[model samples]
Target: MKKATRLLTPALGVGLVFGAMGVSAQSETVTVESGDTYWGIAQGFDGVTTEDLVEANEYNPRAIPIGAEIKIPDGETSSDNDVVTHVIQPGNTLTNIAAVYDGVTVDDLFRLNPGIDPYSLTVGSEIVVVDYNSEFGEDYLYHTVQPGNTFNEIASVYDGVTVDDLLEANPNEDPYELTIGSRIVIPLN
Candidate 1:
């Protein structure tokens, strides 16, 4: 099997920010997932040192329990909504961001924000880090299927949608055996 590539730099300021928790929008709250370590989290963000992770008592570098929503600092710029934006730094891309946030896809993020130019991403342009409670209408409901695509690949194109969702919606059609030039329905919130 191929090894996973590194995504973002890590930060010591790990914390939680959920709705009704009164946490600001600039931060995020993430449950400690399997394979997460202090060193690993720190390496996900930029300029976060090992010593800083040691200082943040909330995060257990060695072993963090599942379902524990730890605070992830340095996400947003303001405190109105929780969707934080981060400028694309050197070596940053949609692929890297999606890798960092499990279940998120490059197309999912790009579709969420039409303002961004995916093909010509600027080095310092800001991109939304977290897209909570996003709108679902014309942009979210439709999808143009590309060549050599499966229902799973098409489903993974959007963040919230899953292969099961596609299967459920298109009960008659087999996702695996799909035509090359067909329009696929995108499950959206």
Candidate 2:
């Protein structure tokens, strides 16, 4: 296979507010690899999700050419820090905040910002965010088990990630019996 060419495109309507999760709205290009898909390519990012890919590339989300290069409009992933803080705003809600970014949820927001009183949030209070789009610059993701959470379920949350991939990332543990609150590593593939 030829080397993956890097190109940048912040094509129309793909921009998002960085304040949502501190993700810059700049887009970059990635050369498609064998077996690559929108969902699979999104696994490498925290902010730029598969949905964003469809919107940014202005193509059908379900169909993308493997050898074609596409733009990724997620700002820089991370230089070192794995998390970003979102300052609580007046009338802000975790659910709303999570909706502003792709591949993240209110539960994820809660998980990263522990002990946050959702109802009593101050306008300027800061909360950590585990934005998936930003994880591209990082190495792995940490998933805290909740009641009834399975590897399949967690993998489902992150587009194109599978139980087998998760298992490969964590070889010493039992996927069926994951302990609650225990950390599970989602390694880069």
Candidate 3:
């Protein structure tokens, strides 16, 4: 029987290991640069979220040290076909841009472009918007609030999800004042 062996290359910041069964695992890492945020790093990878990086690294997302290496989890490779970008024009607002695109909302724009200030739209700057109807992954589902939808009504659509679960997953949202077209996270059971 063969024993598991692990190897890490400091220069490349990659970790590779092979188990007794000859199964191998590799993790890619990125060095933290100045002015980097978890949300900003997550944007470079497809199907990865700020939550995913936080959970994987177990670090304070707000206080990531400069020069620290961050492990990149296994995720889908980013493809240009999966993203749609729009250049900002004078007097353009996220609300109006969303209105021009089918199935896009202000919340979606905000979510896609983190650290964006709605009040400071820069002309010629690009922003991303995604199709809400497209599946992100099995980890969670994105649901847009409708005009007359409640937490209870949303919970009823998914099996084994309660209003409490919804509240817990979305700490920043106001249950009683859900805005129409706002997106919420629906945790999977």
Candidate 4:
């Protein structure tokens, strides 16, 4: 009887573990549309970050082809409190838009609103101001370099971020010889 009890206990524990895994593994797929970015899609769902969507699909966030089907992890719902959007006004740059919000930076704007041309501000276009539920913390955010990405371009996207700051955070990485798919740290000022 003792031997049977021991075996049953371990088997029951294993069953419960597998059951939980099955529940968490639930996910749904969505087709990528024109002008759809990973960050933009994540905004439609609450508690889901661009990183989550990217990691789940294992695709380059910067170059997701249109009409491609991607997996969106299930169980996350939309929450209005988690994200806020701002409509661009005349003379509004990412810098000035970020300035209007406390603790929001150009880096945050770039991360939240990917694929936006910093030099071209379309008046009346809406962009995400802040994603309070982002997996990244307040002090810094991590960025991965894509093909044809330059240190200067990366620095230019984030307001007030200089190549020097990126160098300081990443001591071993050479800004001039940035490697594809290498991670860079962008420190928030």
Number of the predicted model whose TM-score against the real structure is largest: 4
> What is the Cα-based lDDT of residue 154 in candidate 3?
95
How do the residues 40-149 of candidate 3 rate in per-residue lDDT, one tens digit apiece?
77667777655445435634455678877787765653334345566687878998777644356798888888899999999988888664334445667877677688
lDDT values for all models: 0.53, 0.60, 0.67, 0.66
For model 2, residues 66-134, the per-residue Cα lDDT tens digits are: 767777655344332344455566777887666543345778777677787878878877666553444
- Residue 35 lDDT in candidate 3: 76
TM-score of each: 0.33, 0.33, 0.35, 0.36
Q: For each candidate, how many residue pairs have backbone atoms clashing (under 3 Å)? A: 14, 9, 0, 0
lDDT of 2 at 24: 49
Ranking of predictions according to TM-score: 4, 3, 1, 2
lDDT by residue for model 1 (2-103), tens: 123323533325543332354443443445667665445645655542323333333334456765655444523234332435556677778875554323
**Poorly placed runs, candidate 1 (over 4 Å):** 1-81, 136-189
Clashing pairs in 2: 7-29, 27-73, 45-132, 45-133, 46-132, 46-133, 46-134, 47-133, 47-134
lDDT of 4: 0.66
Query: What TM-score would candidate 1 get against the native?
Result: 0.33
- Please report the TM-score between candidate 2 and the true structure: 0.33
Backbone clashes in model 3, listed as residue pairs? none
Local distance difference test, candidate 1: 0.53
